[model samples]
Target: MRYIAIDVGSTFLKAGQLDVQNLAITHMESIRMPEPLPNENPLRKEWNAIQLLELMKGLIDRQLASCPGCKGIWITTQMHGFIITDEYGVADTPYISWQDERGLEYADKLGTSYFSALMDRVGEKAWRRTGLWEKPGVAAVGLFHMLQQADLGLEIKRERQGKACAASMNDIQTLDSKRLCTLGGYLIQSLTGSHVCHITNAAPTGLVDVRAGKWDKDIVSAVGCQALQFPRIVVGIDSVGHYHSRWGGVPVYPDIGDHQASVLGSLADAKNEAIVNMGTAGWISRVSDAYRIGEWELRPYFEGRYLPTITKLPGGRNMAVLVRFIADVGQSIYGITLTEDTLWERLLAEADSFSQKFLAGERQAGKGQLHVHVGFYGGQTGTDSGAIDCINGDNLQVGGLFAAAMEEIAAIYERNLYVLATAGEAIRRITFSGGVMMKNAFLRDAIAKAVGIEAVMAPERDEVFLGLLRLALVSEGLYASVEETREVLLQKLHANNKGA
Candidate 1:
């Protein structure tokens, strides 16, 4: 059977048809996700929840029309964010992007009291219960929603061209009886008319009892959110309902998060392997059999598995921002427009020379003099901040900046491994995926070197879709679980290769 897999990503909504028997993508299409409102706060990245849901439906329709044999539908989406829905299943608030930073500002303002008291009481309890920390980005909206209900004068402010704009807080009070779901949950509700979310998305929200796959009532009580406001939790194999599409009604499964789905899609060894997905925001994940909370997040993966993930900043997009800055600076300084390729080549050459010099002990990487700290979310914190930290772009040429960023990313990989090792999980191998390393072999080599392991490139570029396809198959009773489906598909692929 064939299945339609939709990935509701941060920047794009990707849909594809997967041939289950052959384990290949037959067709694929990508649609750009709607941009944040210009009038919204410059720091805030958000989208109209209802509008995006409609666009997703349109894309699903296109996929169904193109793939005549589509039998099932499965979806994956960006993990973090809050989508508030009223009793009529209409969105009551804009979807808050995980990149939004207003929560950090709130945390900073609350200072000692926030971390010591509120975070310890509310956040820690939730973390212990759900295996999810109150990460500034992940749980910010949920916390804000709760705080606003208390009438604590907490305001969500937006600025448009320096003019102050305010998001309506009137919706906060009414949410007591309303429903709140993630982007995936809301979209699934629109598609299958099911007010439910899968464990992959639910566990990371600091709102669910991850081990039990249900909302933690204690947390809801502590956070002052109504237990009924949250959507019911379901696993990947659970079929919520049927989506009435161009191909008629198909069994639709609960939507999962893109990160976990990517891990599944990459076909990483659940026991002994790690996955590094490099993109606009990069992350390293290692799957474990059971819940094990630690400094890093223990996220719920498919089939009751847990993933301990360490996030990385300075991903491809961050590197691109620095590259653009260097190009712009070079053009203004010398009346010569330097292309990204040219700059990258020059930077690589210089970085190689720098590496040789360090090996020979002829020079040392300066400490405290320059440190390019990528943001918490792996995207660019500022245009020139990353480049500026590595070199003085005005006075010193852009030689080691790119190298510094690459090294920092590798260091982050190593650091995360160290944390896992400290937690008593020793990973044996790593499988890497992402568009950034599709061309840049140097960065891949650097990561391999830093992690002290050979970074294996995932064979499938459409691993995310493959993961969703597995979910669809499992839902259809073709496989017992995602892991079993992956193993059986691998066996088929191996046998086919042998025959060929």
Candidate 2:
């Protein structure tokens, strides 16, 4: 069987056809992700959900032109972002960026003292009931009200042990009867005409009961969202709808979060591996079968496990900033527009020389320093503050500044890894992915040195799309389950990579 995989990302949209039997991508193409308004303040970070849906349809149609035998279509999208839909499943507003800062204001108004007190009262219970910690950034709570806000009505129901529990009413009335949906849910509705949420995408919303795999009514009430405001939950491999394409009917599987999909597509042994994907944003995720939640935020993964991850908001964006800074400085001083690639090459050369000198004990620490820090979304330690402190001289060149930034990024990754390690999580190896490490060998080695682990590149260049392929195989009955698909794919990759 063959499948078409769509990966809707913040900066790029990728679609491809994969031959399941041979584990080969028949054809793949990527384009810049469409944004509605490039200059608008809040909307700048957002994409038009309807426009994206149409773009996806076009991409799939184009791919079908070459590979008409595709069996299914699976989607994996950027997480923590969402779109608003109407009662009839029509998009009501533009898709909102998860990086929006509205939630910060809301949290600040609540204050640390007040918020901490509230967390002390309901945090543990919320975690137990909803599988989410009470944090502003963990869930896209910062952008939750972009759709609608209303109080929820609850009904009493009995569990298996005949214990009374608060059940959400089926009919949740919003201020205008509109509802919230993730990018995946909205796309699913547009493609298959069904309103549903994949467990992987739902977990990041901070509204899902991670254990029960459903929306927690108490958490919904806390968000002022009625029951129906959240989409119906579906597992990763379930067939959500059938997309009718020109080739034929392709079974569409529920969309999974990009992080979860990357793990499924990249990790050979997820249980003992950590994944670090540095794209527009960066994250370090470690998977475990047990439902463990500690300092790091726990997200639901395929195969009924959990992913404890630390997200870096200004991930690869930091590198972009450095590239521009280097270009500007070079053009003003030397009258040349240097590309990022050139800057990176020079930076690596400078770093190599600096390392040699430092090893020879000839260079001092305080002088000629390039301090680069990328600020965090929330007040996360080691990343909450950013600065590039250096003197205006030969030392303030591209190589030193870029090397310092990479070191800071690696330092942050090391800290996140320590948090997971100290919590008793065993990490055997770290899998690296995303655009930041695409052709940069120096950054990869730097991250390995900082984390004190061998950082191996993911088998597939595009892990999210491969993850969608895994779901497509399961949805079309080519594979019995997600676990089976994962094992088989791993075996195929091992066999293929033996010669390399």
Candidate 3:
């Protein structure tokens, strides 16, 4: 029999059909991200729910038709977003991108508690927390929605351009919630017709009390949003019930965070291991049975909580973030309009050019001064006041393929591994995936060499989809536990002889 796994990612949603008994993938495909429509608002139009959901329905129908007798549908999506629905089923918001920076100015408004400490506690490197309100770009709306209206009410706020800060009047480049749509709640809604969120997204809300695994009233109040609009909370895999009671009673299973799903596919070991998934961005992560109330040492470094939970970044987010800026500059210079146009081509060309140039540079490769400290995230904390520390990224370049770029990615990975090794409990084997691993052979080789361990790469691993599939396993009664699934998966895969 076949099972369906849907990976809900930022750029596109991907799906794959897996043979349940054999754990083999039959077919997989990802659709293009549709452009936004002329809607009530430009941002709202970008997430055009009606258009996007229709696309999802069409894809879902086609995939299921191909995989006759498919057991269930499991989905994984970006965390920290939720849709406000009335008692009936309806969408109140679109997908809220964690990359949205609406929450950045929040820390600035908190007055005297010294948001720095709390900011540190929130784990800045998480990527979700890297925006103006001190929250990541993707989750700004959710924070505003979930926070008490009385706290961030219109009367008490300040505005820059047209938008206002959550607390008091202030000026900052905040992300509009409408621009970034919803996340977990909608994914669940689309599947089982239930409006619930998984632990992963809830943990990042700045609303959900991570320790209790429930929404905290104080946090809710502090956010200046509402609690009533949110959905019910559910653990990973507990069957979202039968899918809509339509199409012969197929079941719907939902998993946790986007990275968590990939973690499942990487080795199925739900234990301790730092997952370094280098896609549009690069990240490292490890799971703990119990969530620490607050762990600053654990933050990724650069962009705040803007990254996946598995991400580790002592090098910070600035370095990686800049890669894109550099890419933009290069593309402009090359007259290439589309920056994210191609995967392998862009990566190979840039890295190769940079390597050639750096090897041939004449910037006086002498001593102390020659030692380069590439800061995309943490280093940005001081270097230029505004920088990202994590260096391994797809986009960057103040301009051109500065030969230091390759070393930038490598150096970033090396530093983050140090933090990853220290933050969580005992370390298990490291599993790598994402766009970065899929494209960059040099980065992979350097990673294996730097990590100094037996590293495995699945030339066929579509982690985004596989991660979602693993969640379906939990949601469906087909498996007893994720741990069991992990054991089976790890045993089956032929580990590569180090990095290929």
| TM-score (all chains, Cα) for each model | 0.84, 0.83, 0.70
Q: How do the residues 1-500 of candidate 3 rate in per-residue lDDT, one tens digit apiece?
A: 67777666766777778676766776787887665333443232225444556666666777887877778876667655544433444443343455443333343355523233344434544323321224343343434522423344332332222232344212111222211124645655766666676665665555555444566565444444432555566654556666653456777764456765666566624455666776645566665454332333122111112222523232323334445665676678885554443533565566566555544353355212122344444212212234233343432443233324445556667666666565556555666777657656666666676667656675355865554544455545676665666655555554432433
Predicted structure 3: lDDT: 0.51
Pairs clashing in candidate 2?
A: 347-399
Query: What does candidate 2 score in Cα RMSD to the true structure?
Result: 7.8
Worst 10 residues of 1 by lDDT: 378-387
| Tens digits of lDDT, candidate 1, 1-500 | 78888888877888888777666777788888888855454556667776787788887888888777677778888887877667767776677777664443344445533324345556555667666555555643455544643475555543322234565455456566677788888888877778888888877676778778788777666666653477888874667888886568887778888888888888888877888788776777888886777876677876667888776335777677767777777788888876667777786777666655443342353333334555433233222233345344321334455556666767766776667654445778888887666556667888888888757887677678877777766766777778788777777667877999
Against the true structure, candidate 1 has what lDDT? Answer: 0.69
RMSD of 1: 4.8
CA RMSD per model (angstroms): 4.8, 7.8, 8.3
Name the better of 2 and 3 by TM-score: 2
Compared with the true structure, what per-residue lDDT tens digits does model 2 show for residues 1-500? 67778888888888888787776776889988864534334413545566777788788788878876767777788776666666776655556556543443333334443234334444576755545445544343633333222222333121212223333333234434766788878877877787888888887776777888887777666555553456778865767788776667777778788888887777556667778788877777777778776777778887777877776534767677766776787899999986777776776787766655542342444455556776733454457776777544554555566667777778877887788774444787888887776766677887788778667998788887777777666766787777788777877888888967
Candidate 2: TM-score? Answer: 0.83
The best candidate by TM-score is 1
| Candidate 2 local distance difference test against the native | 0.68
